[model samples]
Target chain A: MNADEDAWERGSGVRVVPPVQPRKLAKVPFVEMADGRLQGVVSSGSDIARVYVSSITAGTHGFNCSTNNNRPCGGLGGSSPCKHLRSLVDEAVLQYGRERVARYLQIEVGEDDHLMEGLEGTRESAPAAVVFSRFLRHLAYLELPVTTEPVAEMHWFPATRAVI
Target chain B: MLGVQLAQLHDGDRPGVAEALDLVAGFDDALVHGFARLGEERAAALTALAGAVAASPLGPAVSEAADKVAAGSIGEEHLTALAGARTALLGAVHDALLDRLDTALGRTRAAWEESASTAAPADNLLSGSRSWLHELGITGWRGVDHDLVSSSGQTLEALLAEPRLRRLAVLLDGLAAELRASCPIATMARLPVRRWADLWTRAVLLSQPGARPAASVEPVTGRLLVLGADVHEHGTAVQVQVHGVLEPAGGAPTRLVRASVAAAKVDTIVGPAVWRLLAGHPVLLTALAERRSLDLADMPLSSSGDLAWQDDKATVGAPADPFATARLQLANANAPAVPPLERHPIRISEPVLLEDYETDGDRWTLDGHSIRVDLDRLPASGPLTPELVAASSACIGLVRWDAGGWRVQPLAVQATVKRKPVEAHTGDWAQGPTDPKVVKAEAKAGDAVAVLRERAGRLLRE
Candidate 1:
């Protein structure tokens, strides 16, 4: 299928695999990598990773990603598929070839699972930058003079999806 | 004293009679209204009297009478005229006369005021009298020529000697006393007095100390601080360096030795020890112990003196025992009479035969019979050249001793390990993007926040 069809399928919550091998191209890790526009490093040893891989499209090494405001999208090893993670995977596959990419992808998945558990615990602990930004948003509303009226309403992506 | 002299004067014949009556009316009006307008009344009375004398029928009679009074050629008629007219008009005339009398009296008072300002020759005789006049609301004085009036016309001073002046004086004295008691400094400039007696009373009262203002403050300007520390091993005294802003106590900026530890000492001060103290130093324990307490003016460092390298951190050795002598002199006929040894007794020992040796981790153990050089006596290797001796005599007094292969008292033993000051760089990150790669990689990690700093350039701040 074309790219749009694959995106639609993915959006519909069904995983879609790319069709052609493109064997001569750069080898990428395949721990069920989802496609997001972010780039960053993911480490299995330190259990630290940068997400937002699509942001890496802006530069060779750099990646820009929304952390406190935007939800993690897709790319490397695809849990939230941000730009940084996509760049890390793309760079890893390019540098190390397919076999090493697969091994590292396994490690990345294990690390992602552990990190998700840690994140769950951390949710009940001190607030993350994401939660802090939310708090700041709430505070911003409260701090606005009572006389002010909202000029526009904001809607998240899935929540703003049109009804059939 | 004649009975006829006591008779009333003829109103029509009284000198300046209308003006005198006017003054009496004004005075009574002033009394009723409080003394707020007394100055205006005095001016009015004086002006009216001057006008009346120039225009009234009694004008020439008053002149002739005034001339008689001036010439001291007063008669019984003059005395009778004054006594008979001792009505309200006469009373006003009496007061006007007293007012003129005060003008003359003021000359003497003005002199007393000048004298009081000098803070010298501390007595005045007219103190309580004027204050008494002030209290009784009798603050006017205008005396006519008593001799011309043929009235036992008394001067203002003489009038105050009357029993009435006494009552007023007493009442005023009480007020003056209260003022002198509570507000001496404020009143010091303007206490009123009209007589020699008052001057004397003021002089006595001021001498009582309560009337004198005390010193307002004891100011503290600069402090002498010493910052010296010991090198425990050699016991070679190192003086402290002083530093800080020195402010003069009151007026001019004073020069003083400050901030260095050595600037706080006594006789041991290198420069002839004669330094001028810009300010005094508080006696402190470190000052007393180190003998560093010296006045700011006397800082030896101000003059050309030997500049010793202070705060040398290399001095590290066991504290010297007061009883032990590090060097000793030796004399022998066979060996040339030698100077004192400079090598440390702890660092070196006499030549010895090596018997056994073993290595244990970082430490090495060796056994040998060695010739013991008495630490209290001259160092055994001391008979060396002056240059070598100088090079070997470490200010720290620690020395290394070699016996065959083994050396004693390693020079690098650690003593106090002072923390090196951690250098921290603080400044706004260079203007541009908040990207970390933009900064010198070797530089420390930038603060996670503060990424959005912008350059202000040369814009004038509000």
Candidate 2:
């Protein structure tokens, strides 16, 4: 949400989207399917200063949630993932896409299979260090000056071809 | 080399200018003996112009001609007239070249400057087309060469004044003028900037002799009334060029559209055999046989007129009448003057229709009326072309003004088979399924065409 600093400078709280979809395509600012886990950082809806580092482990379907300083999230002591992890999967579906996320998690998904519904796991405490660091790097990319030069990470993307 | 001499006319270096002048004079040096032998005093006119005649606009030209003649080169009769006259002729051509360049370059500069001043970003989707030229590999131009051939607004400031484009612009402008001069259709202006650049790019890549195997691509949009299709093998690649009336989308008038594709691009199509490619694309035979108008969306169109069989959706409809199309769409239609760069024999440079044309000895005549038929320029479609000429009295032929008159080369014949009227293209060009088994094969085809079609979708990705 801090990426909205430009909008704040422009005197708007955030870039406005027309009243269409109830949620943004990127509800969780960063998400990726990596290291046998569906992982990302989710901004805490209640606290402006906080974010939850979340992950759903592959095969075993184990899950974990924690803050930046390794404070275990209270919502981890439950059968279901907290709202932050749920929102992370929702945005992951919009980002890496549903089929990709399902496959990476080793789920033999059915048509209409909810990504989170296919996973059943117990409380798991995994270090949130790597995902939080990746989230910080993503924010750094957003701060880059607008340029025509190709972005190294986006070489395979179609829209980036022109900038090259 | 003449281009270099023209630029040197203003050079202060005497030896360089003199050498260039000698070359220019030498270009017509052979004409000296020929014209003098014919007893025309004009041959030696340039010889006596006085080497000091440096005050004339083509002063350096006069001084050079005189020096070449005076320095034991005969300050006299025959060589003088022709070289001197040739110098003047070159002067006039040089001036005309500047005029054409000024107009074209000025328009490009103005358009780009206007776009530069804009605040809000304007949607430039239909602003112009993009192309992929296959050289060592596919090299693309956003539009034009990004200089003289650049699309409006793509470049800024004096960037459009780059020398490469300006130099080629002269040659291309000359080519465009010659093509228009021979074209029978009333003169419209030259090709639009983007199309002109497309022609220029093709000219640079595939214009060489025996270079048919090389390929370049452009996209085809809108609907086209299919007239005919043919495939040719050029050692390295099999080429297909389609001729038809293109009704461009966004409500543009119907005009003749030529699109091509090379078989070499199809990595799976093993060799450059017509049958090998055609077997995979039986639809080419289907369209050539029956009148089929196709509406294409984002297809890889290459060369002069071949839209290579690719996975692009080509929705075909019936009632494909080439004759009726010529009448309504081509008759009185402004024939586009494109740079005749493609090696493909049937460039469809000037498409027109005729009825009850008169022929005597070798001359053919038409009313120059409307309601045109498929008229191919080369008439290289085998024996059937001449037969359509000798046997069928009424047929559409591509006409060009050459040797001081029009030449009608027939491509399609208007006749009656059984009780019904039939429009038949001269030769059997497309090779695929024939008889009732392959009648509607154009709408669908083998995997080769499907692969070619699907590649267009992923072309930009990889």
* Model 2, span A61-99: residue lDDT tens: 899999866898877666878878888888766544566
lDDT agreement of model 2 with the native: 0.40
> Which tens-of-lDDT digit does each residue in B134-218 have in candidate 1?
3223212121111212111122223223322222222232332222222212223322211211222222232221132211222
Which 10 residues in a row give candidate 1 chain B its minimum summed lDDT? B329-338
- The fraction of reference A/B contacts recovered in model 2 reads 0.00
- Give the best candidate by TM-score: 2
- Give the alpha carbon lDDT tens digit for every residue of B1-462 in model 2: 012222332223323333333443332332222221222232243343333234555466556654454343432222333234434443333333333322321211111011111122221221121111111011112111212222222221111123222222222322232222222212322212122222333333321222222234456677777654333321112334456776767876555555443232211222111334434444544555566677778765443233544533566656577777766665433233222222111122344455565544454434422222222232222223333444455554443221112234455666544545545563244543343433343223333333333333332132
Q: TM-score of chain A for each candidate?
A: 0.21, 0.70
Q: Could you give the DockQ of candidate 1? A: 0.01
